[model samples]
Structures are given as structure tokens and as C-alpha cells.
Target chain A: MIIPALIGSLPRPVSLSKKLEQYYLGRLSEEKLEEAYREHTRRAFENLRRAGIRVITDGLYRWDDIFNPLIRFIDGVEVNGLFKFYENNFFYRSPVVKGELSLGENPIPEWLNVALEIKEEVYPGAVLKAVLPGPVTLAYHSINEAYESLDELAEAYAGVLAELMKELPVELVELQEPALAAELSRATREKSDSVSAETAKALIERLEKVKALWVVTYFGTPRGFPEGVILNFDLVEGTLPENYRGDLGVGIVNARETKMERRDRLVDKLKPLLRKHGKLYVTPNTLLDFLPESVAWRKLKLLGKLGGE
Target chain B: MELQILPTSIIGSYPKPRWLLRMYSLYELGRLPEEDFREAVKDASVAVLREHERAGVDIPWDGEMGRSEMTEYFTAKISGFKFYGPVRVWGNAYFNKAAAVSKLEYSEPLVLDEFRWIKANTTREIVKVPITGPYTIAEWSFNEYYSSKEELAFELARILNREFTLLEKEGATFIQIDEPAMLNHPDEVPIAVEAINRAVKGVNVKFGLHVCYSNYNLLADYFDEINVSQFALEFANRGFREMEFLKKLTHGELGFGAVDVHNPRIETPEEVAKAIRKVMKYIEPERLYVNPDCGLKLLDRSIAYQKLVNMVKGVEIIRKELAKEGKESIPFRRSA
Candidate 1:
């Protein structure tokens, strides 16, 4: 069965975006802001339900990027300079690891719990997936003064994430590792072994607490993946992995562009792969956060149409 | 063109007044007509130019009042682009993101009208026209047309070449191509430099490249390759840290950012002067130009004005110190 799913974040509606801005500016009260967030959360779920996206995200409306709000919850990390999230215009604060890593007050479970409650009310029986920044990507983008190597830092992050994932009451979690493709590709081209497949696999292994896990990589040519991992390949900047035995995510939707995909063309491309892969979910190659809200919504609707076909 | 040593300027864009923003909202809602909206923009541009003059800025543009976001504005004018709406660049802030849908073509001059308006309005001998650079425009936009990203950038560069040549023909002396996205991909720096060179091909104007909030060290290797007279970089935002790279700068003048525009806190003349003093250890004052870290559009208008006042005051402090060494002023070097 084919299912439509968002890879990372769905663009926040303009009204909610304004409210968030006001809340950050200290113009809006937390109570009122929370009310707005709850209302927006329901709207997002309703939109997804109406569009027939079964495997849904919470829209990650509160997140600036994958690193943010989560980084704020982690000990020994300070938010630093804004770095571009891959080649896209969207930027996230680079996390500076100044001390040993540990979980502080994790708000992911709380945020996800609220989303799940809303999902139950708004779209009963819909699968709500929790999205987190994968350890390898986080370690690569972060400034690491505290750790000996990026692998060590990634492992440290996996320990923190393992603890956090245990708290999340969700069946599946999508760990976004764009660096797995973009950075690693560059590293390989330059003959620098900055991050290794073993390191990434080790990090994923530690997160066995989650009921199910999917590693989504995007933005460049993805190298080797450890066996038995449910992998999502971004077909836009990347190709499907060779001879992989797992449930595959067919990321046929172009999340980076504003152009609407022709459903017929996408189906033709996916037909051969669809027959081969046992379990497949149709998704965007990258986060829709790069596209305009209207464009992203249209893409999601297109994904729904593809899934239905 | 001749100019004073340590000449003060803004890195383009002054904060739009609240009234102008309201006018913009009304204009977008169709409450105000296009003619009225154009007039309002003209009024705002003139007002900001006067403000820059009063703030003692040596070289200023029309505050970029006519343009909304840099790349979006250009995309709207050029062919083969479509806007989907605004995308968030950071917390609560967004810019209208566009996608290259087909082969990019130059239908009209992009910044010439604004350049003509600012040139007529400002009393300054040179107005720094800040066009969003080709590398940045291609990098920021979603490319659906080009076979490769390099092709898209070069296509943009060809179109921009026409725009820049037009501006130069219109008696514009200086053009600061804003390429904040240039250094994002270090591997693509060669293409970026090539794109910039292609964009400025045969334009023959004093060119400045304003790159903000980036590791300026990356460009140090390719500084001579890029055909620009000045490298306007943001330093104040990072507390003027990591400027040891300045020692490697072999060619062109440096547009030193003395005031931090992202922060709301007002900087003192002494503080700005101290930052200038710290930077002057690597480069001489004659080759240095003082400006804010980036566009002042993010700051409140009053705060933006005051920051410029302090920036000019800071430059004045450095000017006095340079005068003590008989290096008071120098001719503005017109070639890269």
C-alpha cells in the first residue's frame, strides 16, 4: 500500500507564522500563543486528513529548523551562527557543543503528545510520525569543541536521542540526515573521511528504543547505507540505493522547487521501483520548508493523488 | 572618483518607516492604486536618501525602498521565473521565493529605473546600486530549467550583464552586487567568481561585493579572481571576531562593517572606533570603507538612523587618527 507522507516540516500557515513572530517578540502572551498553536495544529491535521496524507507529521510548526528548539533542550549546547541548511535558502542556528551532551528538558514528547491528541481528534487512526535531526547531520553541522571527533559527537547525540525517543509515544520516527548525502558526498570527492557509514549505523543502532525508525537522506548523492535500515532516498538530488532490501520511501516529489509535478510522469518513473519495493511511501525528496506555503501545500496534495493512484 | 579616507556608507537598505509598510499593505490589498503606491515608494526612497545624507554617509543608495526582497524583485522583472509565495529564511522572517521555470532571459533593465531615481534624488557623486548577484539569485531560486546549477548561474550572469551595462550607461558609477549566498558552497566558489565576472563583463564601473554573515576566509583564496574593487563584509555581528583572515587579503579595498545592524542595542562611537582600530592593524585606513554589518532594514528606523550616526562618528574618529599620520584622505580607486 502506498502512503503519502511529509519528509520533515510543512510550512506554517501565514496567520500562525505571524503569531509565532509576535510571541517571540514578547508581544503575545504564552497562554494566547499556546491557544494559537493548538488551533493551528488542528488546522494542519485537518488539511492533511482532507488531502489524504495518512502517514503525517505534526507540521513541526514550532521548529525553526530541525536543530532548533531541540538544541535549546539539550545541555552543553549553545546556539551559534546561522548556517544554510544544505544549498537551500533556509538557515538554522549552528549548535555549538561546549560540554558533554545530555538531555535537558525535552519538549519533543510534550509537543508530539499535543500533536497526537489533536491527530486523534482531527484525523482518527492517522499515523503521526515524529521527525528529529539525525545524529550524523547534527554532528556535521555543529561546532564541536567538546568532542574528540565527529563520530564521537554523533554517538554522544545518539545517546541523548535514544533517551528522548523513549519518551516519545509514537510508532515511527524519521531521522533527517541530509549531510549523509551532501556532506559525505563532498567528503568522498575530496578524499576526506569526515563521517563514516559505520558511525551513522552505530548511532542508528543506539536508537532501538523507537518502535520503528526511518533514515531519510537528501540534497546530494547518498553513499552506502547499513543493511536492514528502512531508507528514504531523495530522487531529486539523489538516486535510489542499489539492491536494497527494505521498505523504501519513493521521494518523487520535488520539495525544493515551486513547480507542480505531473502525476503521470511521476507514476511512470515510480512504476518499476514500486513493483520491486515491498513497502513504499511516496514523499518529497527534501523538506518542503524550502518552498512557499502555497507551493508546498499543492505538492502535498499532489503526493496524495500519487498515493491514491 | 575622489573620496575621503575611511569613507562612511551603508550596506544598502534603510528600514522602511511604519507608514510606508502600512502603505505597502494597503497597496497589496488593492486599497491603494498602483500609481499611489509608486508615489509612496518614491517618497519613501527620497526620504531615506535624505536621511542617509543627514547621517553623514559618503556613498548611499535610495535605501532600496522600491525593491522588496533583493532576488524576488529581480525575478519579478526578468522572464522565466514564477513566485510561489514567501518562505521563512529564519524565525518569523520570510522572503518571497521564486523558481526558474524556463530559460532565463533579459526582458528589461532590472535596477536601472531605481538607479536613475536615486541618481536624480541624491546629491552624492556616487550611489551604490546593490543588485542581488547572479550566483546568489541562482542559488536562492529553485531551478527547474537549467541542466546544471552552474548553467542557471551563468544564465543569470548573462542577464545581469545587460542590467549592469545599462546602469553604467545611465551614468551610474558604483554597483555593489549583493552575494550573501556566494560562499555557502565552497566547491562552487570558482563558478561564483566566474558568474560575478560574467555579470560585470564590460560594465566598467567600480564594483563592490557585499557578503555578510559568512566565513570571509573562504573568499580569501579567490579574492583576486573576483573582479570587484571592494569586498564589503560583515564583521560587527560576530563581535568583530575571526578577522585574522584580513591579513591574507592581497587585492582591493575592504568595506569594513563597524556597526551591528541585527542587534537593537545602540553602539557608541568609541566602540565602533575600537572595532575599526582592531581591523586597521591588518589593513591601512586608506583602503578601508566603514559601513554597518548589513542592511539596516531589520532595525527600527530610529535605531537604524542612530546606528549610522554612530558609524559616521566612528569613521570620524579613525579619520582623525589617520590625519595624525598625514594619511587623511585618498583618491577612490576606481579599478579592481
Candidate 2:
């Protein structure tokens, strides 16, 4: 019996005050944020190690915004003002892509560099994983007020992200393509939804350039997957809804409400699903919010036991 | 019809009922107690609705008393889809890829059933019946049945239309359709607006649209699309940046969120009065209704009550101010 492994990227919360101060002070001397990020990355690895998770990530500990942190590394992107997502109280700022996209000498964010360093330092033998926003998801989430078309912008982003992927030295890279699954309301989809297909194709092509890719879809159904755009990805991950029969990374534990029985049932549900798929990987519903240490441990134990048995 | 004003607002109901937390399994056969659950519905309705009336609210909702969960409640009632589980918020939207617990087959409209239950139990004339609109329901859930979200939304609208018609026939005077999803998918505004219009077609009742925590920049243009008599939005809690756009976009009545519902701290009457004053610049005092920023379901009972008291006091002060200035004042009254 091949049991699924538990793996996830845990991002550390950065205080808004500290992030602003760092941004305004022009303090790029020794990568101060990157140094602070290393400590958090160490703590995350230690936590995952204690929980017995075999496949670990730096938990994206160094970055302030998940997607925008890469702007510093990318050559043509200009940082803009901040915007708040009122529902969740998360903040994001836009980055303007300038003319003639050229790959930065370094593709990984300074935070990810610290994460990679921490992984080498802390868990020399364990697998190191890195995550980046999918080029398509990033393009969609970004404010395109300056860009003429999302398709044009997405193509540029794809090239940059693909080049960046080659530079990062990690076993696996998860490209979380959340926007691909977004259902454009009928009104807008009728006019602009066609761009999504091209965006999806461009993104998949970009990820194909990167090795050991996991194309993760979340937030919507996989109903309208673009036709004839097979990129031979190593893995696809998402919390399958209850009625879906497609391949899924079954999420049993409610990230909001932690219940042991719920977690067990989630594992039970995954057993059959995993049997069908050769190797399974389990991830919680989301990573932004903290899952209690106990729940994380239980999931890790379940995955480890499956692997061992 | 005489308007009755009540004093009490929100009471705490935490550790949500056990059935609500069970995902779509709550509606599974033999999983939940049918009669006992229905009784609990009645009890919840009486408890919250009566409490609001006693507390002097102009209109009272059962506090979403009949629903299991906010977004997932539609899965059990809508056809061609299944409940995946709770949706997790991602970049700008919510994502749920969980498999369906079971295929959805709606024999009757659940919202109608719940509305009837509430109407049968309550004596208040203007019991606010809250429904999750098509755009919100589709946006919040995992889309499985239709190839496109628009199709799924229209289907939801048809079901809601049935429920709205039923409620109208059953003497429901006020219906509030909640559409928080509009904030995330601004492109869905027109689709949502059209769906709502279709749902409430031929219904001779006061229709209110509730959108919370959205950037008013996108919502400024919403009035042109939606056919609602009133737009009840979060303004006081969100601040006054939206009022300018609201003044330009809205031609109908507005419900100014005067109290913060998510925050635990209670506002003073003076603070509430100040917030209302800011809103009055854009909206006429007669066209403005004072309420909490969002639903009080998340707040503790004491804080909710205190907020309501302050909100009502603020409205009274505003009314007095308008009267002294020779401006027409609309008295706050509850449904008779």
C-alpha cells in the first residue's frame, strides 16, 4: 500500500509595521528581511520535523506578500501602492511589468533564498520544496490597469516565471493556479473569459519548463480545463469537493474547525482515492490560517504510517 | 400597518450548532434528526427574532436562524451540484475543490420552507427573510453541475425565484438577499444583479440587497444594474470614502451600517451619531436606515445589544437634528 505524504507551504505572518519600515528605509544592504526570514524558516522546518513531515518547504517565511515579493527579483516589475482585501484583511500591492521582459539573474525572492538556505542547514537529507504563484493566477490577481491585455501580460509573466523556476534548486515546485478555477461571472465571461484559456495554456507551457512541477488548483471547480494543453506535470493538488469523482487531494480536516473524527474521516476518504492514484500527497484546505500543531501532527503521522506500512 | 421598533439587537450563539459543522452530511439521510432539527429551527427563530423585537429593532431577522451555514446552505437545496465542504479564501476569491458528498436533487425550495416556518411562528409583520443570492452562492461554492458559473448562477436564481414567490404569497413584507461574493468577483455584479432582479420579479414586497466589506469603488456602479429598492451596505464600519460614490450611484433608500458587528467593542451613541451624520451628506435622512455594519451573528450578545442601543440613539439624535433644521425626518418604526 503506497500511502500519501503530507506536505504544505506555511507562510509566516509579517507585521505590517515592520514591512512598511523596511520598504521605506531603502534597506537592501544585507537583506534584513531575508535575515529575519531565516529564523522563521528554521522554526517552520523544526515544527515540520517534529511532526515527522518528510517533504518540507521553507514555509514561505521571508516574503511579505505571497506574489509581490518576487517583484524585487524580477527586472521589469515596478512596485505600486497597497490594496486591502476587506473580507480577509489581507493586503496586496500591484507590480507594473515594464517593457521588454528580461529574466532577473536570480529568480527566487530573497525570502526563498533564506528558505533554501535554512532547508540545507536544518534538514540536509530531507526533500526541499519551493512554491510560487502560478503565472496565470498572478496575472489575474494583479491589477491590470496599466496593461493593455491580460493575455499579453500573462505571456510576459510566463517567460519570467519559467526562467526563475530553472534557477531554484528544489526537488518540487508547486504553482498554485487559483484563478484558473475562478468562474468568470456570466456577464464578464461572455466578453473576456476567452482570455482565460490562452492564459491557462501559456501558464502550463511555462510550468513545463520547470522540473518536478505540481499544478495546484483551488477556489473553483476544474470543469473547463483547456483542451489540448497537456504539459505532463508530475502532480496536481486540490481539496476535492464531496461530489467530485476526479483526481483530488482530499481535505478531510476543516481548517477552521479542528476535530479529530473529521480528520480521521478525511484520511479514510483519501485511502480509496490514494489507492487509485499511485502516490498521494495530502495538504490542508488552506495554509494562510494556522492549523493547530496537534492536527498537523496527526496528519503527518497518518501520512508517515501509510508510507511505512 | 404600524411600524414597531425593538430595542435588542444581537445575542451570542457561538460554538455553532453541531449539525451546521457537519458539512453537507448534515442533510444526508439518517445523519440528522428531522423533527428535532425542525424544532431547533423554531426555537432559534423565536429566540433571536423575539429577542430583536423586545430589544426595539425596526425589523428582525431570525438571525439566519434556519440555515445550517452561510455559504454551504445552498448545496443541499440547489440541483446539479454537491457540497464539497467549506470554501477557503485565496488570492481574491474563495476556492473549494472538494468532491460532492452526494448529487443534489431538490424536491422543494428549502428557503421557502424555512420562510414559511418563520412566518408561522412570528407575529411581527416585517420579518426580514435573508437569502444568499445566485452570484454569492455560486461564487462561494464549488461549481460542479454546469460547465460555466453563469449557468450555475441562473439555476440558483430560478430556485430563489420560486422561494421569493412563495414568501411573497405567504405575506413576507421584506426580503434581504445577501451577496458578499460581489466584493471578490466584481465582474459578477451584473450577473448577480440580473439574477436578483429575475428572482424577485412579480413580487410586491420591499427588496433589500446586502453587500458587506466590499470596495465601494466597484459598488459605485452597482445601482445601475441591480433593481433593489434599498442597498444595505457596510459604510460606518468601512468609513466614509464610499459615501461620495454612493451619493452619485444610488437613487433609492440606503441602509447605512452604523455599528460595527465584527468588532467586540461597543460604540457610544455619540460615535454612532457621528457616523450617521457622515452618511447623511450623501443620503437623505428619510432615505437612510441605521443598522450594524454586517450581521450580528458573529458578535457577543452584550456587544450586539449595546451596539443596537447606540445605533437607535444615534438615529434619534439625527432625527432631532433634521427636525430642528426644518428637514423632513423619517421616524424609525418596526413592522406591525
Candidate 3:
């Protein structure tokens, strides 16, 4: 059976996004801002349910950006500098490593609880998917002052993520690794030779507890990878491997673009994989946050329809 | 194009004054008067000229302070174009990439009036005007009018060529066509190059083509093929890695960028000279022009001014070395 899933984030509504930005800037009251965030998350989950997407996300509404919450949870990482998040116009606060890594006891569990409560009330049968930056991605993007090697830093971060997965009730874990794609964007021509196969294999071994660990690659396809981890690939940029016979996760819809792909077209495109794999995950090529809120939801609906067909 | 030494100039654009940026937004919203906004623009341009003069630049612009983004600045001036919301290109870097819905026609002279203003104020006989290239304008925007991007870029080339001829009539000595997106689409380079040639075909002036934040190696193959007098490219950001590509060039002056605009740290005069010296090993000193990697718009005004000052001083260091070697003032010719 095909699973229609959101890789990460439904686009926050235009007005709500504005308010959240203001909230970050301290122009808006905290009470009022939290209300806005709650409102947006509710709408995001409902939007997912309407699209018939059984695997819903918490919309990552509380996240200021991808690297923030996780880095905030970790002891050594500090958001003091800015680094380009691939070739995209959005920037993430560069996570600088100051000391030995530790996941400080915090309220991250409570952050997902609100969304999980909303999910149970609205779409009872829907499986909640939690998204995180892959350990290799986190380590590569971070300024590792304490860690001696990239693989070492990756193991430390992956260890933390593996622990968090146990505490959360997330049925599916999607690791958004756009950088894993050989050529992330037009501006980025270099191959991602940073994440070694050994480190990826080690991280996958650590994440064995994650019910279904889907390593999602966007921008372009990973030329090579560790074998055991389920690879969620962008169908546009990703080619079906000839040798690999495993559960495949294919992203048939493009989240960055405004153009729509019809369900029939997507169904035809996914037919070969559907016949080959026992379990299939249908997703957008990248995170849907880049698109206008209306267009993103429509694409999700198309994905859901494709999952059923 | 006989230069005794390495001449100094800016690629295009300077940092906009905070007040000017505010007025630009306010005026667009009808909160501020057009007269008030235009006054700020004029004042800002004057300030830019003064900064260049203070830095002792041989060739300078009106600071490209009159416009905001390179391509969209033209979009605002052209007819039959509808602007869209901000499209993110990199982290926190968004440009309102517009599209041409109908046939693009000039409602008025594109930068003629602004050029006239800068000319009236400056004593320099030679000044350069940089207009966004057709290929970049087409590439940056969503195309609705033309069947393909190449067709749309050609149409833009025809439109900009009209302005080119007009600039020549107005006695503009140097003109630069900016195609920062040129390397982004390599397969379309020939079409883009063709469109560029059409834009300045008959107009006689020292024409340059500028590309930034891209791999210069991708462009080395067709350097001589490009129908332009100069190739103004950014190298400071890449730590001057591809300077070896200069040895392959058969013709045209190289606008060598010595200051890093992407980073706020100022490169010292000695450091900048070292970069220029690396290029001199491949090309003659007379063929090299000093400039920053790209526009200083993303940087602070203080950083921009200091960077220009240091860059101008760097050229001075190389000028002395060139004079000692008796290679200065060699007439510009095809490199053997």
C-alpha cells in the first residue's frame, strides 16, 4: 500500500507567517503569538486530512526554522552565526559547537504533544510523522569546534535524535537531507562528498528503533548511500536504481515549483515502483513551505489522490 | 583602451542609504511624495560619486544607487510586465522575480534621465552605465509572452539595444550588461551571447559583460567568442582560485575583482595587490582593471567605502610595479 506523506511542514498561512515573524522580532505579544501558532497548526493538520494524507506532520509551526529547535535542545550548539541553507533564499542560524554534545532535559516532548492532541481529535486514524535534520546534515552545517571529526559529530547528533524518537509517538520518521542530493540546486554544482558511507550506516544502525526510517533527498539524487535505510527520492531528480530491490519512497510532486502535476500523470510515473516495492511513500520533491499556502495544499491533495489510485 | 596602469572601478551598485531604502518603500505605498523620493535618490547618487572620487577611482558609476535589484529595477520601468512576490534564491535572499505578460515596450527612456543627472554633476568625461542583461532579465522572470526563454531574452535584447544606441548618442563611453544568471544556464549561453551581441551590435562603446557568484571555468571556453570589449567578473569570493583561466583568454580587458563584498571583512591594500599580481602573471598589467567581487549592496556603507578605498590603493601598488617593468601604457591588443 502507498503512503501519502508530508516530508516536512505545510506552508504556514500568509497572515499567520507574518504574525510569527513579528513574534520572533518581539513586535507581537507572546500570548497572542502562541494563539496564532496554534491556529495555524490546527489549520495545517486539517488541510492534510482534507487532502486525504494519512501521514500528517505537526506542520513544524513552532520551529523558527529547521535547525532551531533541535539546536536549542542540544547543549553545545549555539545559533550565533548564519550559513546558507544550500542555494535557497532561506538561511538557517549556523549551529556552532561550543562543547561536548548533550541533549539537555527540555520541553521538546511537550512541543509535539499539542499537535498530537489536535491530530487525535480531528483525524483519529491519521499517523503523525516527525521530521528532523539528518545527523550528517546537522554536523556538516554546524561549526564543530569541539568534535574532532565530522563522523564523530554525526554520531553524537544521531545518538540524540535516536533518543528523541523513543520518547515521541511518531509512527514515521522522515530525515530531510537536501544536501545528500549530489547537486542540491543550480547554484550548488559540487557533489556532497562530506557524509561518508560509514557515518550514514552508523546513523541508520542507531535509528533502528524508528518504526520506519525514510531518508528523504531533495534538490537532486544521492549517487550512493548506505543500503539498509529506506531512501525517499525526488522522482524528478531521482532515477530508479537497477540493483536495489527494497521498499521505495518516491516524491512525485514538486514542492518548490508552482506548477501542478495531475494524479493520473503521477500514477503512471509511480507504476513501476508500485509494482516493485511492497511499501511505497509518496511525497513532495522538497518541503512545501516554499510554495504559496493554497498551492501547497493542492499538491498535497494530488499526492493523497495518487496514493489511493 | 590605452591604460598606463591597472585602472580602478566598481562592478555596479553601492549600498543604498538606509533613509533612501525607507523612502523607496514609503513612496511606493503613497505614504511619501514622488518628489521627495526622487530627491533622496538624487542625493544618494551624489553621495556615491563623492565616495568614488574620495577613493581616487579612475572610472566610476553614479553608484547604481538609483535602482534596487538589478533586473527588477528595469521591470518597474518597462511596460507590459507584472511583478510577483519575493522568490527566495538563498537563505533570506529574496528577489521579486517578475514576468512579462504582454509585449514589453518602453514607456519612457530607461536610464537616460538618470545618466544625464550623473553627467551634469560629475567632471569625469568617461562614466559607465550598467543595465541588466536580457538573458538574466528573461531567466530571473517567469516568461508568459514568448514560447521559450531564448525568444523572450532576444525580445529583451532588442528592447535594451534601443537604450544602448540612445546612451551612445548621449555620449556614454562605457556600458556594462549584467547577466549574473549567465552561468546558471550554461546550455543557453550561446543564445544569451547572441542576444547580448544584438543589444550592442551597431552601438560603438567600450562594452563589458558582468557575471557573479558563478563558476568562471564554465565561461572560459567562450571568453573570446563573446562580443564584448571587456569581461568584468568576480573572483574575490572564490579566493581568486580561477585566475589561471586568464592565460586562456585571447582578447578583452579583465575587470579583476579584488575586494570581497559577500563578507564584511575588508581586504588590506597589500592583500588586494597580491590578488591583482596573481592575474598580472597571466595577463599584462595594462589589461587588468580593479573592482570588488560584486555589488556592495549587501554590505554596510562603511564597509563598501573602505573596500573601495583599499581597492584603489591596491591598484596604485601594482601601477608602480608595472612602471618599473616598463609594461604600462601598452596599447590594448589581442593577447598572443
Candidate 4:
């Protein structure tokens, strides 16, 4: 079976973006802002239905970045300064771990409930999936003032995320682990590699206790992922490991650039992989929010074509 | 051209008047005529230039009123670039990002017309021209066509070199290449330095490198290797923290940031003087230029004007102290 899905996040429409800004500046009421979020969430699902995506999300319209929802709702976490999201032009507020980490009153369950209601209304048969920052990526992207080492930080993150995942209504989830493939300096890379692997192993053990998950890596080389774990590789900047054997995510569509991908050429390239792997997922190389709304829409149309619908 | 000790200036952008912003929107939506929009831009530029002069700025340009952004404005003029749509840089702000579709070429003179207009309008003998640097353009744009980022940057450098030569030929004295995107990738510092050197190659004029909101430690090692006359850095936002980094920058003049442009509270001259005093221990007064941390485009016009006022008044305090030692002025060198 071939699945068509997005990595996570869709660019909010300019109108919703304006409303968000107004809400931030206290010019708009929270009730009015919630109306905008609901309206935009409905619009996002409608767009996904138009693109014929089966496995979809609620567009993560409220998330400024991958770390946003976690940093806001998790205990022992404080928002720190902005750090560049890898080498891309975008930035995210770094989470500073202050004390023992644990899941507090998370908004994901409510968010997922809203998404499930929208899915049933907009596209009844669609499978709604949740996405989160993997422990390894979260650990490295943060400032570790409290944890003795990054391994301990990531282990704590894994435990907190596992507890959060159990509360989510969705069965399938994606843990974005870009740090596994991130390009770092020689010294930092060496230090992070072992910690990243250990963190990934710990996360796999914890999440497996709840439900199956997909590990998505982008923007750099893909490695260190355990076998039998479903994986996604950003083929735009990375190559799939030849020795890996599992359900594969072929990320052929370029998300960072505005240029369109050739649909026929990509379909032909994935044919061989589809024959070898029983389950294959087609996705964008990175988050679609990197592109403009118009461009991202066109890319989704292309993704629909690749779904062979 | 001669400059007084601690010559005060801005890092290019000033807040656009609200009326001008409205007109700019109308022009974008095709509600206003192009000729009328051009006239409004001229009026705004003159308005900002006069504002800087009133604030006691010694060296003022047109405040970059003719352009909306640093990278987008330059890439829009250069050949072989295509804009898809706007992308978010941060909260509520978006820039029209472009992708390089082919080899970059110098189709027309970028920023030359702006420089010419400002040169004719400003009373100052020497006006500072800020152009977006090549490495910044390459780093910010989507590189679908280039084999590597370094190649694209070098191609951009070759194109910018032509623009610099044209500006120099047209009698622009000082040109500051703004590369706020440089330190984002510390490993790319070598490429950035090489690209900068190539961009200013054979252009015999004073050039300043302006970078803000970045870790200066990345460039501290290659400060002298970059072929520019001045290094305009941001300090006020960080509370002038890490003043020790100035010791590593052995060459080039320093555009000392004394007023925090990111903050709305108008800094008192005493506070600015104290900040300047801390850096004066490392750099001579004649080699240090005082300015706001970065562009004042984000602040309201009234607040921006007051900040510059305080910045100049702060420099005046230091100037009096230097005058006692007979070191109140220095000749502006064309190149390092």
C-alpha cells in the first residue's frame, strides 16, 4: 500500500496569519482568535481533501515551530532565545530545561480532538496523525542548564513525550528527528552522534509501549535509525541508506525550494521502491511551511498526483 | 572627506512615514500610479535625510527609503532570479524570497540610482551607501540552479563587483555591504570572506561591512582577512556584552553601536556615553564611529529620531574628552 502524507505543518493563510498577529498584540479577543483558528483548521483539511491526502494533520496552525507546543505545555521547560532551525532561514524559540522534565497539561489532546472532529466532517475516511519533535532533536536544539548531559535530557524528553502520546487519541504518530541527520561542526557532531543514537533507541522503546510511530529525518544524511522502525528520508538533501530494510518514506518533493518537481519522473523513480517495500509513503522533503501558501498548495496538488489517485 | 571624532550615522534603514507606507501599499495594489509612487519615495527619502541631519548625524544617506528590504530589493534587480511569493522571516514579517534559476548576471545597476539621488539631495560631503552583500543574497535565496552555495555566492560576487565599480565611477565615496546573514552558518565564514573580497575587487572606495544580531566570535578570526575598511557591528542589544571581542579585531575601523535600536526606551546620553567609554579603552576615538545597533526601520519615526539624537549627544560627550587631547577629527581613508 502506498500512502500520501505531509511531513507536518502547512503555511497558514494570510488572513489567519494576520489574525494571529492581532491576537498576539492584544488587538483581537481570544474568542475571535479561536474562531479564526477553527476556520483555518477547517480550510486546511478541505485543502488536504482536495489534494487527496489520506493521512493528514490539522495543519499545526497554532505551532510557531516544532518546539512551540512542547515548550509551552511541558513542565520544567522555559522558553529561551531564538535559535536558527538548522541552516534554513527560519528560527524557533529554544527550550531551556530548568528541572525534572514531565508532561503537564498538554493541549495536544484538545487539539487532536478538534482535528478529529474536523476530519469526520471534512473527510470522513481520512486517518488523522499527530506529529512531535523527537527526543534527540529536542535535546540538541535546547539549552541544557539543568540536565547533567544531553543523553539524560533526551531520556527525560522521551519519558515526557511517551506520557503525552498515550493521552493523544490518534494511533499513528510521527516523531521529527532532524538532528539525526543535521550537519554540525566536527566537534559538536561527534559529541551529538552517540547521544542522538541512544536517545532514538530510548524513544523507540518508550513509544512502542503505546503505538507504532514513523521517524522522519530531513536536510542531511539519514543514519542510526534502528531496523524495523518505519523511516522517512529527505532525498532532496540526503540519500536513503542501502542497508535499511523497513517500510520507507520516499521524500522526493523539494519543500525548501519553490521550483516544481516533475510528477511523472518521481512516479517512475518510486516504482522500484514500491515493489521492494510493501508499505511506502510519499511526502515532502521538509515542512511545507517553508514555502509560500500558493507554492505549497501547488506542491500538494503534485503530492496528490504522486498518490496515484 | 574629513570626519570628526566618533562620526555618528545610522545602519541604513529608517522608519517609513505612515502616509508613505499607505501609498506604497496602494502602488503595490495598482491603485496608485508609478510616477506618483516614485515622487512619494523621493519625498520620503528627503524627509528621512532631513530627520537624520536634525538628529545631529554627521554622515547621513537617504535612510534606504527607496527600498523595502535588503536582500529582496537587490535580487529583484539582478537577472535570472524568480520570486514565487513571500515567506516569513519572523513574527508577522515576510520577505519576497526568490530562487536562482540560472547564472546570476548584472543586467542593470542595482542601487546606483538611489545613490545618485541621495548624493544630489544630501548636504554632507560624503554619504554612506549600503548594498546587500553577495553572500547574503546567495544564502537567503533558494539555490536550485547553483552547483553549490559557494559557486552561487562567487557568481553573485562577480555581479556585485560590477555594481560597486559603477557606484565608484559615479563618485560614491563610502559603500557599506550589509551581510546580516553571514554568521548564521559559522562554517561558511571562509566562503563569506572570499565572496566579500571578490565583490569589492578593484573597487577603490571606502567599504564597510555591517552585520547585526549575530555572534561576532565567528568573524573575529577572519576580521582582517575580509577586504573591507570598516566593521559595523551591533552591541547595544546585548548590553555591550563581551567587549573583550574588540581586542581580537586588530584591523579596520569600528562602527560602535551605542543605542539599542531594538528597544523603544530612548537611551540617555549618559548611558550611551558609559557604553562608549567601555569600548574606548580598546579602540581609539578617531577610529570608532557611533551609531544605533541596527536599522531603525522597526521603531516609530519619533522614537527612531530621538534614539539618534541620544546617540549623537553620547558621541559629543566623548568628543569633548578627545578634543582636550587635540584628537577631534581624522581624514576618512578610502580603503583599508
Interface RMSD of 2: 10.0
**For residues B116-199, could you state the per-residue lDDT of candidate 4 as single tens digits?**
888898888888999989889998898889989899999999999999999999998899999888887778989999999999
Using Cα atoms, each model's DockQ against the true complex is 0.42, 0.05, 0.21, 0.33
Q: lDDT of all predictions, in order shown?
A: 0.84, 0.58, 0.75, 0.83
True contacts kept of 4: 0.36
For model 4, how does the per-residue alpha-carbon lDDT over A1-309 read when each residue is reduced to its tens digit? 678888788875778888987897799999999899888988888988999887887787878888896777888998864446766667677787889898888778888898899889988878888888888888887777788888888888888888888988998888888877873332121233246465667666577667678878897776676555578898888988877787788788898888798988888878878777767888888888788888998988898877752
lDDT tens readout by residue for model 1, B1-336: 568889888788889988899999999899999999999999999999999999999999878998888888999998999877888887677888788998888998887778888889899988898899999999888888888889999999999998888887889888899998888777888899999999998988899999987767778888888899999998887778778888877668999988887789999999999999999898888789999988999888999999999889888888888888988777877676
lDDT of 1 by residue, A95-207 (tens): 88999999998778989989999999999968988999988888888878798888888888988888888889898988888777876322111222366778887667567
Name the lDDT value of residue B211 in candidate 4: 84
Clashes of 2: 27
DockQ value for model 4:
0.33
Q: Alpha carbon lDDT of residue A115, candidate 1? A: 92
Model 2 per-residue lDDT tens digits across residues B1-336: 533221122221222333443522554556667776666666766776666666567666667666655665666655555433333232222232222233334557767766777677666655677777877776655443466667767777777888878878878777778876666655556777787878777777777788776666676676766777777777654444446677664466677787776567888888878887787778766566666777775555666666777777776776667767776434433221
Grade the docking of candidate 1.
acceptable
Q: Rank the candidates by TM-score, best first.
A: 1, 4, 3, 2
TM-score of 2: 0.56
Query: Which stretches of model 4 miss by more than 4 angstroms?
Result: A74-78, A98-106, A183-196, A208-211, A226-229, B102-104, B144-148, B184-188, B215-217, B236-247, B257-286, B313-327
Q: lDDT (0-100) at residue B35 of candidate 1?
A: 94
Q: Give the candidate number with the greatest lDDT.
A: 1
**What is the lDDT, from 0 to 100, of the residue A157 in candidate 1?**
90
Candidate number that wins on DockQ, 1 or 2: 1
TM-score of each: 0.92, 0.56, 0.78, 0.89
C-alpha RMSD of each candidate structure in angstroms: 2.9, 12.0, 5.2, 3.3
Model 3 residue pairs with clashes: A88-B90, A89-B89, A89-B90, A89-B91, A89-B92, A90-B90, A90-B91, A91-B91
lDDT of 4 at B219: 76
